[model samples]
Target chain A: GPKVLQIPSHQIIDMGQMVTLNCDPVSNHLYFYWYKQILGQQMEFLVNFYNGKVMEKSKLFKDQFSVERPDGSYFTLKIQPTALEDSAVYFCASSLEAGGSDYTFGSGTRLLVI
Target chain B: GDKVKQSPSALSLQEGTNSALRCNFSIAATTVQWFLQNPRGSLINLFYLVPGTKENGRLKSAFDSKESYSTLHIRDAQLEDSGTYFCAAPSNSAGNKLTFGIGTRVLVRP
Candidate 1:
C-alpha cells in the first residue's frame, strides 16, 4: 500500500513560537490534505493543496497557518505564533482524486504547546 | 451540527462476533470513505465507496447516496479490529475536503 510520511512523530513547543510540520505525500498523488485531531475528537479538515496552490481551507486554518510544497519536496505546514488550541495531532493525507478514491494518511504528528 | 454524524459513540464486541457502524450525513456527499485509526494514531483506509456495496474479507461496506448514509459491518471480528472507526464524506460545500464524523470507538475482547 502507498504511504504518506510525516516527520517528527512528536513535538513540544512553547506558546507563541513558530513550528513547521513536514509531510511527504505519496508520489504521484496530486491532492494533498492536512487534518487536525484534538484529543477525544474527530480529525477535522484544515486545508488541501493542489498544483502548488491552496485549493481549499477550513475555518480551523487560521491566518497564522500556511502550507507549501516547493520543488516537489515535502508538504510542510507552518504555524507562526502558535496558540494553545493549535496543540493537536496533525495527520497528512494524499490522494489521486477527491472522489471515489482512497486517501492515504500518515502516522500523524502530535503537537503539544506549553 | 455535525455534517457527518456517527452513531454509537463507543462499542464493545467479543471476538468472533459481528457488529455494524453507521454514519449519517447532512451535507450532500458524492463519495464515502471508512478508516480505522489504531491506538498508535495510524489511520488505515478500509473502504472507499460510491453509492454501492463493497465487501473485503470480513468487512463489508455499503453507501446509499439517496439516503445520505453509509454503513460498515464487521463479521468475525478479531482483537486487532479494536480501534476507532471513522466515516468521511466529501460534499460540494467544501472543495475536495472530506467531512469526518466523531468516530465510533470499538473494543474487541477475547
Candidate 2:
C-alpha cells in the first residue's frame, strides 16, 4: 500500500535547457531509484540513492544528471543541458529496504526535449 | 549482453486462453519482480518473488534463483489483461538495482 508520487506528469522542454523531476517517496521508505523508459523500449536503471548518497548508477546516468534527497524531503532528478536522447518517461520508485522487496513506482513523468 | 531477456516479444491470445511469459537472467540475480504496463503507461506491480512461486487471482509467478529464470502465468485471460509485461532482476551485488527485460506485449482478443 505504499505509493510514490511524481510531479509534473508531463514536461516539454527545449534542448540544452535544464529540467528537474520530483518524486515523493513513501514516508518511511529508505531507498529511492530512478528509471527511464524510451518509447518502445525497456525500462533502464538510472540511479539509486540511500543515506544521502548515491549508492549505484548505471551507464545511462549521464554526467549532467544528478539526484538528491536534500533534507530528507522529496527526491529529485535534475538534468542540465538536456539532450534529445533525454526524452523519455522517467519513473521514480522507492522501497522500504534496499534489497528483495516490492518497489512502489510513481505513474511517471513524460519528458520531451525538443 | 542483456542481463535479463524476456521471451515472446509479443503475443496475441483469445479470451479465456492461458499463456505463460518468461524471463532469463544472465547476471547473478537474487530476486525478481513482475510488472504490467497499462495503456496509459502506468507500471503496476504484479509480483515479487525470491526462488519460489506465488499466485494471486488469475496470475501466478515463479522465480528460480539457482537457474536464474522466472515465469509468469496468466489463466483465463481477459481483454483487460492486454498490456506490456516486464520482468526485472536485481543483481545479488547491486543492492536492489533492477535490470529490466525488454518486455512482452500481450493483446487479448475478445
Candidate 3:
C-alpha cells in the first residue's frame, strides 16, 4: 500500500506564530492535497497542488496559508500568523493522477494553536 | 447545507455482527471514496468507487451516481473494525479536491 508521511504527528504553537507542516507523499504520486479536520467535525479540503503549482483551493484556505513542493521534495504547508481556529488535524494525501484516481492519506499532523 | 451527509452519526455493534453505513450526496459527484479513520487518526483508504460496487474481504461498498449516494457494508464485524468511517466525493470534475462527510462512528463491542 502506498503511504503519505506527515512530520510532527502533534504540534503545539502559540497564536500569531508561523507553523509549517511537512508531508512526504508517495514517491511516484504526482498530485497532492491538504485537508483540515477540526475535532468532532467533518474534514474539509484546503487545497490541491500539481506540477509545483496550486490547482485549486477552498475558502478554508485562508490568505495566511500557502503550499509548496520544491524540486519534488517534501510538500509543505505553511501558515503565517496563525489563528486559534487554525488548530486542527491536517491530513495530506497524494495520488498518481487526478480524475477518479485513488488517494493515499497520511496519519495527519495534529496542530494545536494556543 | 451539508454536501456529503452520512447516516447514523454513531453506532454500537457487537462483534461478529453486520452493519451498513451510508452517505447521501448533494453535490454532483461522479465517484465516491470510503475511508476509515482509526483511533490513531490515520485515514485508511477503504474503497474507491465509480458508480459501482466493490468488495474486499469482509467489507463491501457501492456508489450510485444517479442516485447520489453510496453505501459501505461491514460483514461479520471484528473489533478492529471499530473506527470512524467517512465517505468523500470530489468537489470538481477533475477530482482534485474532496468533500467529506461528517463520518459515522462505529464502536464494535465484544
Q: All models, DockQ values?
A: 0.69, 0.75, 0.81
- Chain B, candidate 3: TM? 0.98
| Candidate 1 per-residue C-alpha lDDT over B56-103 given as tens digits, one digit per residue, 9 for 90 to 100 | 999999999999999999999999999999999885554368889999
**Candidate 2 on B1-110: residue-level lDDT in tens?**
99999998999999999999999999988889999999999999999888999999999999998988999999999999999999998864855788899999999999
Q: How far out, in Å, is residue B8 in model 1?
A: 1.0
DockQ of 3: 0.81
The residue-level lDDT of candidate 3 at B90 comes to 87
Write model 1 residue lDDT over A1-114, tens digit each, in one string.
Answer: 889999989999999999999999999999899999999699999999989999888899999999999999999999999999999999999988765375889999999999
Candidate 2 residue-wise lDDT, A21-98, digit = tens? 999999998889999999979999999998999999989999999999999888999999899999999999998888
Q: Model 3: how far is A83 from its true place, Å?
A: 1.2
User: Candidate 3's residue-wise lDDT over B49-72, tens digit each?
Assistant: 898999999999999999999999
Global Cα lDDT for candidate 3: 0.93
Candidate with best DockQ: 3
Show the lowest summed lDDT stretch of 10 residues, model 3 chain A. A95-104
In model 1, the runs with Cα more than 4 Å from the true position are: B93-95
User: Model 3 over residues A37-56: C-alpha lDDT tens digits?
Assistant: 99967899999999999999
Tell me the TM-score of chain B in each candidate: 0.96, 0.96, 0.98
